[model samples]
Target: MKNKELVENYYKDVFINGNVDKIPVYIAENYIQHNPQVEDGQAGFIKFFKNFIKTEPKIEIINVSCEGNMVYVFYKCSLPDGTINKVCDIYRVESNKIVEHWDVIESHVEKIKSVNHNSLF
Candidate 1:
């Protein structure tokens, strides 16, 4: 599968479905993570998500783009507590495996809180 497809499948199976078993298939054994909150490697990835699923966030992808070996995914997720977050993730794929990742996340502000009422999407 193409790197873009690989990333989509990974998100579908793991992030959306909460299937941790697919980690080995889509992620490299020595995966490098740029997210300071998370640890390095597949084991760390799995460990981190184990806690993440507790929130039961409904993950929704907004857009995706790919160039060379990098795939960028934009996501809007609804937290179990009713808050919303905008997340941007970048992944480096090699040999059909995700080898590195970086992400930025911020809580979405309601329109009333915005200065100009520009759309968050």
Candidate 2:
């Protein structure tokens, strides 16, 4: 499979399914994750994600765009508390293997409240 396809499948099967083992299949041995919550390499990423999805089981990929060796995915996670977080993940692939990743996460509640302006005082 192409790098983009492999990266997509990694999110679908691994992230959504909570399959930690799939990390090795899609991630390179020297993979580096730029998230503050996760250390370098696939092992750290797997650990962080496993714990993350425990309370945030509902996840959806909103969009994806790829160019050259880079792939960008926009997603959302619904927490158990009924809160939603918008997230963006960027992947850098080489030789069909994901070598680097970066992510940004922000809660949607503040944005919704600010836009609606319907909050009770």
Candidate 3:
């Protein structure tokens, strides 16, 4: 599969559909996570979500695109308390499997919390 398609399917199955079993299909066994909070490899990826999905937060995909083997996905994540977060995930696909991952996450800022000139979206 293409890099973009692989990432989109990953977000759909794992985050939107709440299907954790699809990890093996879309991700590589040696998956390396750049996020300091998560460990390396696919096992770490799955284990992290096992506890995280307990709140049943929903994922809203905004955009997905690719440049060569690198895929970029931007999405909105709704937390259990109704707070919204903006997320951008980047992945590198090799031999049709997602081998590397990186993510940036930011929570939506309320008007009262807006101390800067930047928009959250």
Best-to-worst order by lDDT is 1, 3, 2
Model 3, span 1-121: residue lDDT tens: 7778878878888888878898899888999999999988999999988887997887877788899999998887887787788889999999989999999987663323666887565
lDDT of each: 0.90, 0.81, 0.84
Give me the overall lDDT of model 2.
Answer: 0.81
Q: State the lDDT of candidate 2 residue by residue for 1-121, as single tens digits.
A: 7777988899888888878778888988788888877888877777787787778567788888998899998887777778777888899999888999998778764347555556411
Q: Estimate each model's TM-score.
A: 0.93, 0.86, 0.88
Error of 3 at 91 (Å): 0.6
Using TM-score as the measure, the top candidate is 1
Measured by lDDT, the strongest candidate is 1
lDDT comparison, 1 vs 3, better candidate: 1
The segments of candidate 1 whose C-alpha lies over 4 angstroms from its true place after superposition are 108-112
